[model samples]
Target: MDDVDETPDSVLAARARTGDAAAFGALVVRHQPAAIRLATIVGGSLDDAADIVQEAFVKAYRALPQQRDLVSATPLDPEAVALATTDAQLLIAALARLGERDRQVIGFRYFAGLTEAETATALDAAAGTVKSRTARALARLRQELDRSGVRGD
Candidate 1:
């Protein structure tokens, strides 16, 4: 398509399924705001929402190649949704305890899998800044998890 922005989701999805990074990037850009909003509604804050959305997109990107089609005909099972909601709630709660900068660093480094240099570019900061922020964020997240009684074992 001349305008990838104007391309339909199904078309983009199909292209992405075939390993078209541009098509997937376009899809992510198109749906990110709404996805973030939905995630916020479920996760209870913007920081948690961003993490949830980023994680979901990352999962989807990994799984898309194995799918026979982009859209599913079957509806979601209530039991599965309920089961996932509990885990999601816990993650959201943990993420919510982090500061905005902590969340941003965690989201870029862990959830989005961006390198220090890439995250620095995205945040318009120096690579050293990204590295330090990521280290601090992880430490804080670990403390939060420990306080919440979530054993890493």
Candidate 2:
């Protein structure tokens, strides 16, 4: 296996976020099996799971931030991967607890990195409404994280 094949998923994702198509392709190749397994578990059909995984990856690619130099922003120590995985799991669980509207606003504003106006357009709401929803969603997400004993360090 080459260096890219041995690279961690978080590293690949970081590269993919920086507009590296090959890195994204590597990510898809590496994680496709697990993603398919997850889709199968949730969708209950292998055929449907493959379609769902494809769509999900497409959305994920679209949602990646346009500009972020995160890979070099923080040096990766041995514990970084474990910490990142734990934090991601915590955030995902917290998001799952949110109401649908709250989730949508958070996903659009943060996950998709859309401006309030853009989010407003996507949500069919006014910019002010999007702003309000984003604030409320953030508050709710904070509450969820706090309740889960996830501390920002």
Candidate 3:
């Protein structure tokens, strides 16, 4: 990890796609904090969630691209991901603004501790779609929080 702090995720992901192990590792390092927070929310008991989410996710192949793109697409900070991690009220307020399906997807995956397969079953969609939808839902939530001026420390 050379100073990847300033590097855009797109470049890191492209390099990762080409099997540049260093670049792949760099990408992982850059996204680790945000991704870990995601896993906790979308996957177990707040205390038990980290292990469950960590076990369920390893590569994040499907998610990495969108997450990478989201970095450029939104003004939300990695720190905002931490906002929901810190404040229950802010998370709920943001969640309330999402459409029904988005809210359900997040609720099922995170609040209810439903597996992607289980959530897909609940949503009547395929497993892959669940993953994609969850990613989009989270991005939207973060965007909403940012737009609404929710600050987390």
Candidate 4:
């Protein structure tokens, strides 16, 4: 595919899954900056942000099979919908600023579109705990964004 054809994340993901190291490298190149920024926002130092991003990508790769399985079971297209929505990018950036528990809660619930019960199962926490963490993480994100001059009103 031409460079112009490289924008689709699903394509990149599929390539990466087949042991295409170049595709996986491209994915890392595409997402690392945002991931590192997220790591830094989550209280990691600049030096450690790179490491955190590396780890996140590793985790993303490892979880890809399950994600594919889930996608196959559902008809909805998360990639298409996410590309069309501004909230997707905002949510990713916001996730970087959350603590580990808060991040996992948000990632599983919002990004993964899992129900509270499903999130609880994935997180090994009570459903109520997932709900509470989601609430607190969102509130904290709003507060942080406001402080960072992201909130307009």
Best TM-score among the predictions, by candidate number: 2
Report clashes for each candidate as comma-separated counts: 0, 0, 0, 0
**Residue-by-residue lDDT tens digits, candidate 1, 16-130:** 9999988988999999997796455433478977876888888989988778874555656779988677656656677778887787777767766679999899779999999
Candidate 3 Cα misplacement greater than 4 A, ranges: 1-86, 151-153
What is the lDDT of every predicted structure here? 0.78, 0.78, 0.68, 0.68
Q: Compared with the true structure, what per-residue lDDT tens digits does model 3 show for residues 1-153? A: 567877777777666655567776776666656555654444324554455445444445544454543324444577886765667656766776787678778977876568999999977999999999999998998898898787545
* Model 4 lDDT-worst window of ten: 67-76
Each candidate structure's TM-score, on Cα atoms with residue i matched to residue i, is 0.52, 0.62, 0.43, 0.49
- How far out, in Å, is residue 104 in model 2? 0.5
Model 1: lDDT of residue 110: 72
RMSD in angstroms between candidate 4 and the native structure over all alpha carbons: 7.6
Q: In model 2, where is the ten-residue run with the lowest total lDDT?
A: 36-45
